[model samples]
Target chain A: MYLRGVKELSLTRSEEDHIKAIHTLTRRDGRAATNAISERLSTKASSVTDMLKKLAEKRLLKHEPYYGAKLTLKGEAVALQLVRRHRLWETFLVDRLGFGWDEVHEVAEQMEHVASEKLVDKLEAYLGHPHFDPHGDPIPDKHGRIRQRKTKSLDSCGPGESVRIVAVSETTDGLLRLLDSKGLRIGTTLVVQEVHAFDGSMDVKPKSGSAFSLSKDVSDHLQVEPS
Target chain B: MYLRGVKELSLTRSEEDHIKAIHTLTRRDGRAATNAISERLSTKASSVTDMLKKLAEKRLLKHEPYYGAKLTLKGEAVALQLVRRHRLWETFLVDRLGFGWDEVHEVAEQMEHVASEKLVDKLEAYLGHPHFDPHGDPIPDKHGRIRQRKTKSLDSCGPGESVRIVAVSETTDGLLRLLDSKGLRIGTTLVVQEVHAFDGSMDVKPKSGSAFSLSKDVSDHLQVEPS
Candidate 1:
């Protein structure tokens, strides 16, 4: 894996972002519609359509009438690089800079497009080869390989089931705050003790902290892997 | 004093850069011409002209015909924020991420425009409130005050005078290689023992290592304050 390997392509901010957004939306559904992407990005449908045409012309995506689009390999490469830079910067900002987990995404988003492979590796080494970013997002390896998760929400686990919380959402700084208030954090072996359907909450006992209840909102934002 | 305070500006990459470049040039020379800026950045003179008009329209720069330009108070504030971000990132990269002194500049140049006041403070805290970056560049205080220098170049000193090498050119990685070969680094003390005239060279003794000869070209690129 060549970390400072030749960049496959240089992309404009808007274009690179559009590709990333499309990849995210298509990850589960296998394709993303113009309308969905437009709504997701808060951009108008017409602008989305225009971008689709431009991206299709650039061979970054496949476009066919009303069928929506998918990322070509070239597009995926750029998207992964963007994701790599973003997560790496996020990890650096939080773990090394003493920034709280919730406050890193906005700045990391802007830093993702920075064109330095060496910076990323040095940062990865500095952070001790962290597999996940501050928010629990998996950082791609030097070759842009992200480990597919064999995990689910921590709150959904059965009582006495051992699991490790792997990630959280950067957008949910408030939710992270809520988790903090409840004494839940990554690597804090979560053992689900109770589930309440009335409010869809869970009582979780961390490795050392006292047992606590997490609202459904908090549960949904956390990712956990069975140990 | 408030490192966690959020910033409110939404300047683009180029615009934020304009504010900072103007701040540096204005502070150094009291005035900066568009063409002069073009040369400093190695961008087209026409591009500088276009950006000058845009920055002026934003009330960031006080531009005059051929008379050179200056930053308004508003512009200075923006520039200080960027400088804070730049030097802080440089320190974070070199001190925390294992990036070498010669490697942080290009990365920091791109990172300086990231719009995050809180991030900078967190970084300063993470780095234990360092007063300087790897290149010996002063890290501005939270209040935008840069520490003044009390050292100068070893080459500028007369025979048998002692001095310390502070910072070097952001553009000279080769000079870094040369300096490293001589066991010289930031904070390393050296005494000018002799001056060579054929190539404007000089001889100096290092703090720990034996004496070595250095070229004038190398000395010119070293940005020392005094010792």
Candidate 2:
């Protein structure tokens, strides 16, 4: 299930989806409950229990009676495939389809299950092997390799520190609208000029070969390799 | 070539390649030269002439007393986009990757013309809405829509006339081999009959509910109506 790089991994789409849901839910909550999985997958709890057992047998998830399950290394492989395809497709949609960054995540979700290594390889080649997708998520290379980026929230940028935005989170159009109003986007160089403790927001500037200030909360989700 | 049932009448990848070359050459040869075009495309001269005149009045190819010029609205939209992506990557290979797709015609040649709709949608979806790439294929969807499908091939049926195999023209290793061997595949039916041919193909009995004979060609192509 864990493709070290780009060799094909064997698992059905549903299995991968279950693994991914577990991974996501685990990231949010401490454990992956059967109810949580049923809610995420829109399936009956009974069905989730059935799948939990099936995955446990495959050593994909460590299931504990009444508690839920944890993804084993084997399961992690499958989850990673969903992640890889998800980000890759997101990038392709926004970059190649003329989609706004806010519009790509959902579409990529559906496209991620397409079964074709050659298609993915060709896309990577066609795309110059991009390292990120539309929402600023890192794309796993054919080898499932990820570039370790040193980044923190825009909120973390101290006054007088220079920062350039590499990506924005695509959760809602609200973020996109806010950024657009502020002229902030990936690779936009903005320096922290001042932070108002009174309102948790700040003044911002664009990196258009110029200096500027930005609000603090908006900066939190934005990753900046501060200089 | 006109694909049956393709209402989308966009100039195909091959058609665009022909247009680009024809446009450039029409400036030479005193006009568009069919023989030269045939040499360029490695197709026959007669086919080139047929396509040239067809394109000319359509405004893609220019022809005057066997002489020619360039594109028109109907032609340039498709031609320019194809040219834009092809040259962008062709140039990118030499400039970025030390080695291209063979230095890349084998792959690029095919990719250069894959339907822009699919390419743009998938690319933007995967690449993070990159506005531009090293190759400069305009890295965004010039057109907003893409066509996605769930169709499969027809080579996986048993000795029967009506069993729908689902899926089509797969380039994968498992599928190609399976189809070649007349084993498990997609949308394929055996149509029970004793071909009793001299060329050594199997002839199975009972078209449905049982297995029988098959021709290699029949086993290789032919998609069935959906079941």
Candidate 3:
């Protein structure tokens, strides 16, 4: 009964993707420009504008053209549901289905759109109420409560600093595969050996592997806690 | 690698629904009229015509006005994929997610559209490659192979006949709930005490329960094997 009372909001898969992209893009500033949304979703700015207008009319978000857009409380709730579904399915794919951490994201992306309150709650129970997803991101509970952790992107670590990989933010397959290839995962300890100033890449040494240089794009997606 | 080599076919939710409906309608004769497809989907015939044309162009089906639409080989493959996903998810919901047989269909309906071949293959394995779903429908394998059973509708049993429930078809919530109230499920044993020829309703007694009259609608969905 945990997922009870959440109506099956009939939003297209594209709409849900748009809402999630907006939420992530505006996470820091609390608003995201149409162009930023377009960039995140890999769509055109004009299409983003049209979708924003439609979403605003649906009262899921507030769109102010020439400026940016932010989720209304209703939109935030829906986004939380999407997030909860995504993380729960990710956990199931890895923990139960025996999928490698690097291979779960794309499948979970499709699974997350299956909107059933009962299904989500049942899966949560089946997974014994996991607090975090396989990617190390917090899995929101039924009430949209997320466990907060003091973690920063690996790019923020200075030379000689040792930290534990707590989460991976942008979980694209390439980044995950890169982390896999480097023997880095959630809880993997690594020390920053050097910082390349020209491209902002870092030479990091994992506890069990030789030191390697990771580009800014890869390092920026990695979140870590001081070890 | 089980689900490898299957391209993620891009089809909208509405398009998939239309294709599934047509697949069911044309299943008997390998052809279904547009009006029949529209009626089954509860949509207008003109709209069905438009969709049929689109599906034909996509090579999912062959449509001719005033004639019936028949699924092309490609269309049958896609429809079988949908069926495979539906039955597999139904098994997961009931057998693993702890959902009742009656409560899983709607959720599985949403889940069946998740077009991830890897997820489907993983789920099939996770469920130990279940042969039949909770409602007694044969779950299609990775190659769209279904297990056939020799079962007949409960309405087909004559008076004084004994039968065991094998499967339930047309699993509407109302019908399943009705069966649940009557303490009937897969493998439940029952005896047909009397059959009303006028209406085809049967008065049957479960192995443990007293006799009850089931309307033709209810009996039609109940598949039974001779006991």
Question: Ten-residue segment with the worst summed lDDT in candidate 2 chain A?
Answer: A1-10
Tens-place lDDT per residue, model 3, B53-120, is 88989888877778978877777777888888999988888888889998887888888998877788
Standalone chain B TM-score for every prediction: 0.87, 0.43, 0.90
State the fraction of real interface contacts model 1 keeps.
Answer: 0.96
Instruction: Give DockQ per model, in order.
Output: 0.70, 0.08, 0.73
Off by over 4 Å in 2: A1-10, A27-50, A65-68, A209-217, B1-227
* Candidate 1's TM-score: 0.85
| Candidate 2 residue lDDT tens string, A1-227 | 34654344566768878998998788668789999899888999999999989989877789998988898876776677678778876776566556777666555665676555655676677777888876566877766667768788788766778877777653567878777766677777776778888777866666564545555556677877775
After superposing candidate 3, which stretches have Cα over 4 Å from the reference? A1-9, A28-30, A158-161, A191-204, A209-217, B1-9, B28-31
* Backbone clashes (count) for model 1: 7
- Which has the better DockQ: candidate 1, or candidate 2? 1
Model 1 RMSD in Å is: 3.7
lDDT of each: 0.77, 0.61, 0.85
Q: Model 1: per-residue lDDT, tens digit, A71-157?
A: 877777777777888888888877766777767777888888777878877777877887787777888888888867677876567
Question: In terms of DockQ, which candidate is stronger, 1 or 3?
Answer: 3
- Grade the docking of candidate 2: incorrect
Q: What are the RMSDs of all candidates, in order?
A: 3.7, 18.9, 3.3
Candidate 2 displacement at residue B210 in angstroms: 42
Error of 2 at A116 (Å): 2.3
Q: Positional deviation of A85 in candidate 1, in angstroms? A: 2.6
